[model samples]
Target: MVKGKIAIRRITSPKSRQVTFFKRRTGLLKKAKELSILCDAEIGVIIFSCTGKLYEYASTSINSVIERYNKTKRDNQQHHVTAAEIQFLKKETESTMQQLRCLQKYNRQLMGEELSKLSFEDLKNLENVLEMGLKNVRSRKDQTFMEEMRELKRKADDVEQENVELRKKLRVLSQDHREIKGEFAAETSSSKEMSKSSDQAMPDKDDIPERIHLQLSLQPKAPSLDAHETEIK
Candidate 1:
């Protein structure tokens, strides 16, 4: 006759539970050994009776099997951690990429390259922002321009002062030059007049001798005695 299937539930009686645990423990250890031999696998089994008796089996040393199991569990946990970190990085990268795309779109909109989606209110706000930015830029530019103009004016004033000083120096030099030239002319004229006076005061060689001869010839000739008696008769 065929037997009915066992329900496999916990036995109510302590004695029956203990018996079932022993039988199952033995069968489990035997199956583990057989499986290891058949599949060339490392296998381990462990059980505890209701009375707290320990039972165990291993294809290799129990300590070695336990160590291998612990090592494998640790490797699996490390792998899971690594995979989770990779997934998180991928998610962060995707989020960053999305933010980058948003920024690019916003930049294009700000540059007026993508205006189709902007509402009237948005356009008004953008216009106001642009106008404000323009005003600020113009204000800065004007301030810089004024500063440059002031600098240029200061430099021009400095140059003008230098020119005035140079003119004064030139005027003084010119006056000095004029005074030197006048002194030289006066000296030259005085030397020429002295030369003329010296030439006039010296007597000529022909004048002195001719004057002596003229004086001698002009003396009255003594009258002859015969001419005088003829005149008287």
Candidate 2:
């Protein structure tokens, strides 16, 4: 036994093999105890002979080590449930992983990548979402268009008011010119009559009634989205 490292090949002699087993088993138990004590670690050792004899050692109380061993055994046994449960859990895990992969694929598709292997249900749902999104975009666009129209109308009103003011100023300038000409000579009676007629020509609320009517009539249309399908998904 002491000549060199023994061959890993099977031992032919029963007596010699038994002797080696006993000696090695004793040495292993001794080492385990020493290591446990030096490091303050819990240790348990169990050995079974070829003849089916059981041997055990523990650094702490044997009963405590045995209780721990039993707990470990129970845990190990419980961890391996029925084969049916294992299969069910495996199927569930596989299905979840597949769904995750499909969701990632769909996300890529939403970014405009061409794809393969998607279901009809996935396609239908995607179409619905896209349609709804487009509808919202159209609604917002219409809102902005209406607002821009209103702004344009307001600018037009401001321009018209400025035009009216300019017209008034022109009339006043003409009147001044007439007065200056009259101071130099005699002014025409027809020019003074033209000034009185121009003052009476300024616009009233009757001219702006159409614009007010348009503002009063504008309203937003509601989105015609379906309710049932959105609730289901």
How many collisions per candidate?
A: 0, 0
lDDT of 1 at 206: 75
TM-score against native, each model = 0.46, 0.35
- In terms of lDDT, the best-performing candidate is 1
Residue-level lDDT of model 2, residues 126-199, one tens digit each, is 78888998999999999999999999999999999999999999999999999898876544577777877886
On residues 1-233, what C-alpha lDDT tens digit does candidate 1 reach at each position? 99999898878988888787778777888899999999999987877766777888989888899999999999988777676889999999999999999999977877888888889998899889889989999999999999999999999999999999999999999999999999999999999999999989998777999999999999999999999999999
Worst 10 residues of 2 by lDDT: 219-228
Which stretches in model 1 have alpha-carbon errors above 4 Å?
Answer: 1-100, 201-233
Give me the candidate number with maximum TM-score: 1
Which residue pairs collide, candidate 1? none
Candidate 2 segments exceeding 4 Å error: 1-107, 186-233
